[model samples]
Target: MGNINPSLLHVGSTLGAVFMALMVIFIRLKASARPVTLRKIWIPPLGMSTGFAMFVVPEVRFPWWWAVTAFLIGWFIFAYPLMRSTVFEERDGLIYAQRSKSFAFILLGLLLIRTVLHEFINRYVSIPQSGGLFFILAFGMILHWRVYMYKRYTRMALPKAPIPQPRG
Candidate 1:
């Protein structure tokens, strides 16, 4: 990869980000179309966990404090909007994710923020390290968001007790 051009890398990563954004939107729509399940709620974070292998690469390593700070930022800050936008409702004895009007905008805003942060962070670190840090951040966001979704799904999925009838 010694021959790789900087401008090309920029263009490629930009395109990749756009593609990922589109995929996320597409997946969200498809997921909403189906009844929410515990399996579905848990799958994303589990699958995303595999990305941690990138840390094995020396170029991607960062200080433990950096990792912790990134994760906390994602957990406390980035996950908030996602949790708010995601709501599970029982419909016809099945749980469905309620569509939020602000979801797309929230995603776009996050992507913009991440892109800007990526540019800023890249100046201070190698591309691989930056990627790893952002990966940790994203993992934290997804983990917390998925946990919230799982809790909501289970709550909605549980059978409700009937109200007591008043005796005349």
Candidate 2:
């Protein structure tokens, strides 16, 4: 324990987060407005849920209220901005989405916020509790963002009603 360096841990985490943010920025830059499928839209939430399940320990005790609060905060603070930053358009018979640069910045901001909060929580909470809470927070953000995207895509994909023909 005496040999462990807290600054090193913080530096490593920050570096990893910066790398991820850079990757996201690169991906966003290369991504163009394209037609999206239902299957693709559902993948994020499903993946996040699966990851949450994998991280969850059956024996570790977690506060239910804390999880709920984290989830709600993630949903409102992170997910809403991400969803709003995504621009959707209907072209021809397909639904297309173009995520703005602000989306990447918002994601980076969320990552930074989560990291700071995790470090703060680590001061008073056990590792298991902090990890579990963070997992729940990420799950909520991804779930809400994907669900909103799915709904928006489906609504935009719906067939428009044909105009009524006037009497000849």
Q: For each candidate, what TM-score against the reference?
A: 0.91, 0.79
lDDT of 2 by residue, 62-146 (tens): 7688889989987887788878887788778777777586877788888889888878988977655676777788778878888
Give the top-scoring candidate (TM-score): 1
* Candidate 1 local lDDT, 1-168, one digit each (tens): 268886677667767877887788778977887898888888888999999999888878989999999999999999999999998877788889987878888888988998999889989987778888888998899999998998877777778889999999
* Model 2 clash tally, residue pairs: 0
Q: What is the C-alpha RMSD of each candidate to the true structure, in Å?
A: 2.4, 3.3
